[model samples]
Structure formats: structure tokens, C-alpha cells
Target: MAKSTSGLSRKRMGEMYRTMLRIRRFEETADDMYMAGKVVGGVHVSIGQEACSAGVCAALREDDAVLTTHRGHGHSIAKGTRLPEMLAELMGKVTGLCRSKGGSMHIADVSKGHYGAHSIVGANMPMAAGIGLAYQLEGKDRVAVVFFGDGASNNGAFHEAMNLCAIWKLPVVFFCENNQYAVSVPAEYSTSVDDISVRSKGYDAPGLTVDGMDVAAVYEASREAVAHARRGLGPSLVEAKTYRFFGHSRGDPHYGMYRTKEEWEGWKGRDPLIVCEKMLKMTAKQKKAHADAVETEIREAIEFAENSPEPEESVALEDIFA
Candidate 1:
């Protein structure tokens, strides 16, 4: 993408573009694997919402913590989680992030400062707040970032976490990836507010909304939000108005049933990758080069997962608490 004059450097913009492309390709490969019976369990792909995760995570430090929702593969990838391990986890291989136990929804890589991806809606919000509290007590400048959907914004956990984070002046950023759907229900039908960021006001926290499809916009907003938190100014909420180009999950067959074909086409026309390509004025050769590199990486990851051995059956009960 074209480097914003005052914001991201050209190199950083290039990194963002590559990161977004990697997320898109990774999800696409995972979808194909799921359909071919290689990947088991529920698979939620953030195909169209890559920019939000890429931009937000790009603005964070390596030691900063992050909590993500069920649809968090892109988030983990953006936060430095390895693609091979993530894909292996989805395929139930022993080489997976959680030794194939967490599947698609529960991948966690604490080494990268990614707390974990939770399957439960709105569950990670409070967990992120607790992480923030810990950082505060330890006198660290680290910040906690939580990624949730518009649906989760209406959940009680979201309300409670926002209140506590604000009250304690905890360094946290509540990033609501408003993809406009809570499963089959539309946000317009489910949420009373037009913008999810408005809810931040009730907690006395700063709130802002950005065009999630635009990576630069997201990056700018997130940088400011993260900086505010790092300065010990408390929490902020960023509502990214974006769209998912697929069904809520792989198992959900009603992909285009709820929304109109025109709506889908309109959003796809603004595909984040395409937009970034335009901004960068990338040539066909450059685009092909980028695509080829990402495809090779993804193919190698899949091969690694397929070649990895499964966990021994004897160890199945080892991690259980019961």
C-alpha cells in the first residue's frame, strides 16, 4: 500500500500488505483442507477481515498480550504465531500449537504473547482485562488487546470488562471487529447502537470507529489506541466496521443465505488485498511474486502438518484435570 506520508513507512506498509496476504491465503488453504477432511472441528476464517487483525497487531509490541475470539487464526498469525503449527493444530497433528487438542478455536501461543483463542463468545474480554490488571500490578508498560465480534459487544462480559478496565485505568484496547453478523442474525437486527464504539462511553473510555477494510485507517487508529494505553491513560475501544466474505464457520452452509448477492459483491469489490494493491500501485509481476511467495509458505505448512505424527494415545489423559 502507498505509505501514508505521516504514518507508516514504505517498508512497514509493505510488511502490512504481506501480512494481510498471508492471512488470506492461510485461511483459504485451511478452508480447502477442512472440506477435504484433513482439518477437523469448526473452522472460522477471517478471510475478508484480515486487515483488522494485521493492522491492530502490527501496532503492538511482541511482549504485549492479546486475547482473541473463535475466528482468530488471522489474529494469531498477525501476532507472530507460526502457520505450520496453527495448520497442524487444525489438522489434529501432534505438531499443533496445543498438541492438536485445541483445534481451530482454542489455539494459544504464550511464547508470542498471544493469550489464547476462546470458542466462547465474549469470554476473552474479561480474560484480557485480567491480563491488563496483572501488567498494571507488575508496573509494566505492556498492554492487553482483545478482539471480539459485534455480537460479543452485546454480551454481558463485554460490558463488565469494559467497566473494570476503565475503572482501574488498565492499559487495554478492546477491538471490536464488527463484521456485521452474529451468526445468522444481522447486527442491525441485534444491536441497538449503530456503532459498537459508542458503548465505550458508558464506561468513560475513549471510543472510535474505523473502516476496517482499510488497513491504513485501522493501523492509524490502533497505533493511537495502543499508544494511549501504553502511556498509562487507561483503555480505549475501537470498532472496526468490516465484513466476512464467508459463512460464520465452515460447518455453516448458509454462507450467502442471509445477505444479498449484491451486498456480497459490493464488499468483495473492496477486498482489502485489492485495495492495498491499488494503493501500492503494484505491478502484475509484483502481485504474482507476492502471491507465489505466500502460496509456497502455505503449501510447506500444510506439508509439515501432514507429515507430523499424531499425539500418542497414552498421553491423551495426561493434560486432563479431572
Candidate 2:
């Protein structure tokens, strides 16, 4: 939108816009379902952070592996997960991915190269490195992308995983969706550096931070980082400066006790939905049409999930990782 810095074509721009809308609508619908007590476990939303998910996944291939954080619905959607099955998974239906066993935090569709969504903070980094190593050993050019939050960046796993990937030159992209807050703790108080990407130097890898609200900026950065890893250039850290519109999970307030109303309003102004529409110069009719299409899709997904049967209890323990 700003002088074509990313230089994305109109088609790609529109596709990314659609992706952002799909994630936005999907999360909103899921949150509503959670509130209605129609889902299992808790729902961690990535509503305002759609640009980060959509932009990065847009740069990746369907066969490239992906590991997601708890707040990873958008990541799954961006990585080409079917709406019906993903929603069904959240609904704990037999038709869902993992046959309703994995529910919210553990939805895995390996057929699409999605390993799984790990609930433990920073836990999936090691798994990502392992996958990257597998690709390297097999002489495959595919890369592995792991998504985590700024809070997880401070964990020992962050350093250990990134350092390991860096030293071994593993084909992995350490993607960070720094939403500025980890649950109730603001990043300013917890993190030492203003930009998380700078810490990549500690592991002898390249890194950069981008406007997480701007999909074009994120897309360009992600494309290069993904390409870098695919070329056997080791790991790269990408930090997206973003803010979550909702609380850390379902039942949490928008500006809970810790966040100020002013801070919330400030970030709301840069809502990914608004920013994406503006970037694409979408007309009022076009915007409505896009949102309508997403709504229709989400509505159908909910019906499918609701109508699908739950997994049979007899087979409950059959497909576990044991």
C-alpha cells in the first residue's frame, strides 16, 4: 500500500487480503462458539494478528512443514487447512482433524505439512528443528516454520532451538508473533530488547522485525526468510510487532485489568482487517462481498462440525503418539 515496497502484484494482494479476512472471520466465529459452549477446551485467538499469519504462510509451500503456537488458528487456516475440518476439530467432531482427539491446541494435519499446534510455550521449536533436520537428511528442499509468541522467545527452548538450528544450518524459519503481551504481562516489562529480532545475532543468524499490521511488509520479509532457509542458509528469526484485539483466551476481557483502554484503542486503529482493505483499495461493495463470503463459509463449517459425530470412545486411545 505504501509505494509498493513489497512490489506484490494485484492478484497476490487480493489473495492475501482474502486470507486475512478468512482468519479474522474464522477466529471471531470460533470465539463466539466458545462463548456459546459449543467447543472443547479454550480458544486462543489470533484476530488482530492475522497479517502475521497470512503474510508468512502465503510465502510458504503446501509441502513445507509448520508448527504452531497455542494461538495458532490463523496459522492453520493460512497453511491451507480446510475450514470445515478445522472447525470440526475445534468442535471435537469425528470428521475433524485428529478425529476430535487433538481439539484446540493439538490440531494436526500432516497431509498439509502441519505438524501440530503445541500448547506449551516455545515447545514446538525443537520439533521444528527436528523436522528441518529430517528435510536436510532426506536432501529435500522443504523448510520448517515454527510460530511462537514474544513471551516464548525468552524461554530456554528459544535459544537452544535457534542456536541448534543455526549451528547445523537447519532449514527452519523461527517466526515470532510478538503481540506485545504474553497473557497479562506486557513485553516492555519482560523483554530486555525493544525488538525481538535483534536477539537472532546471539545464535549467529539473520533476523528482522516488521510491521505486523502491514501484510505487504510482512509478506516480503517472510518470503526472503523462507527462501533463505530453503537454500540451506540456516535459521532466520522474524518478529512481527502486533497486538491482539482480544484477551489471551476465551472468557478473558478485551482490555482486562492489565491493559489500558488507551493502549487497546491505539492498536484497534491498526486492525489487520481495516489495514488489509485499505491496502487493496477495496470498495465498500467489494469489502462487504468478501466478508459475506467468509461468513457463509464459516456458517457452513459450523453446521458441518455440529452435524458430525464425536469420536467413538472405544477408539479414543488408538491414534495417540505413544
> Considering every candidate listed, which one attains the maximal lDDT?
1
Q: Model 1, 1-322: lDDT tens per residue?
A: 1223335676777788999999999999999999898987889999999989999998999999999989999999999999999999999998899998889999899999999999999999999999999999999899999999999999999999999999999999999999999998999999999998999899889999988888888898899899999999999999998899998886564355788888888888889888888878889998888889999999999899999999899657767885
Q: In candidate 2, what residue range of length 10 has the lowest lDDT sum?
A: 1-10
Q: Which stretches of candidate 2 lie over 4 Å from their true place?
A: 1-4
Candidate 2: global Cα-lDDT?
0.89
TM-score of each: 0.96, 0.96
> Which window of ten consecutive residues has the lowest lDDT sum in model 1?
1-10
* Candidate 2 residue-wise lDDT, 1-322, digit = tens: 1112857897898888889999988888888888898998778988899998889998999899999988888888899888999999998888998788778888778888999999999999999999999999999999999999999999999999998999899999999989998998889999999999999999889899989999988899889999999999999999999999998885568885788899999999999778878877889999888888888998899889999998888767786666
Question: Which stretches of model 1 miss by more than 4 angstroms?
Answer: 1-6, 253-255
TM-score of 1: 0.96
Error at 283, model 1, angstroms = 1.4
